[model samples]
Target: MNIKELPFEHVTVKALDIFNGYEISFVIENQTFHFLIGKSEELLPLNIKHYFKNQEHCNICQKMIFPTPFGQQPCLPLQKDMKDLLSHLRKTYVVLT
Candidate 1:
């Protein structure tokens, strides 16, 4: 299915009092993916599709977050959401051409 067909949404944009510009959230499939955006054109993926039930370790934030992979791309909106993520990331950060 196409990305537009997926149930995607920009949940919120919070300052979060961090050095970065803001913490943006995109909700897809009941999962909240976070991104750190700077004042300029800087962006980093805090976590994507995190699985909190397991309470695993996250490499990015050094927190107990498990970034689960969107397996079986064709069956669901996994691939579409991943692709849409880049577009939002670009809006928050500089997409190096």
Candidate 2:
């Protein structure tokens, strides 16, 4: 299914903590979209809930950097939209999972 086809207002993103940087996790009902952003480990809690609140100015970029055997190549531009969402934030490895 296309991310664009999904209800935009129903789409929600969350922040998860990783070793080197932060990971932004998004969900559309049961469907999940995960992206990793490079950032200093010092940024605790990552406060993704707040970041997504103002995702309009976001420009975070993502790639198929991770090995996802079970993952299908998403044609949905949600990743790009997400990149745009994190545009103002620090640069990081945005990997869609």
Candidate 3:
């Protein structure tokens, strides 16, 4: 689906606090997703269809997140959110270019 088809809110013009950590969530139009920029909670309107892109890792979780298929990672189920996000990001960006 096109990025437009996937409803989202542009929560940031540019990420404000990477020091707190960053997470991009994907959600269905009628569902909910949780996004944590720092200690505060940001409720997203859509259900997370995925989680990470560009091989960016979670400093807290220390998981190999985003930009999958880049490294020979084992691909664990615990990181499903990350996996889904990576896939969606790849698809979206590849088409945009």
Clashes of 2: 11
Q: Candidate 3 on 1-97: residue-level lDDT in tens?
A: 2333445443322233545344443333322233332323632212222244456444333565545344324323323454444445545632211
TM-score, candidate 1, is 0.41
Instruction: Flag the better candidate by lDDT, 1 or 3.
Output: 1
Q: Candidate 1, which segments miss by more than 4 Å at Cα?
A: 1-5, 41-97
Q: Candidate 2, residues 58-83: lDDT per residue as tens digits?
A: 22223332223333344234544554
The positional error of residue 12 in candidate 2, measured at the CA in angstroms, is 9.0
TM-score of each: 0.41, 0.35, 0.28
Worst 10 residues of 1 by lDDT: 71-80
Ranking by lDDT: 1, 2, 3
Number of the top candidate by TM-score? 1
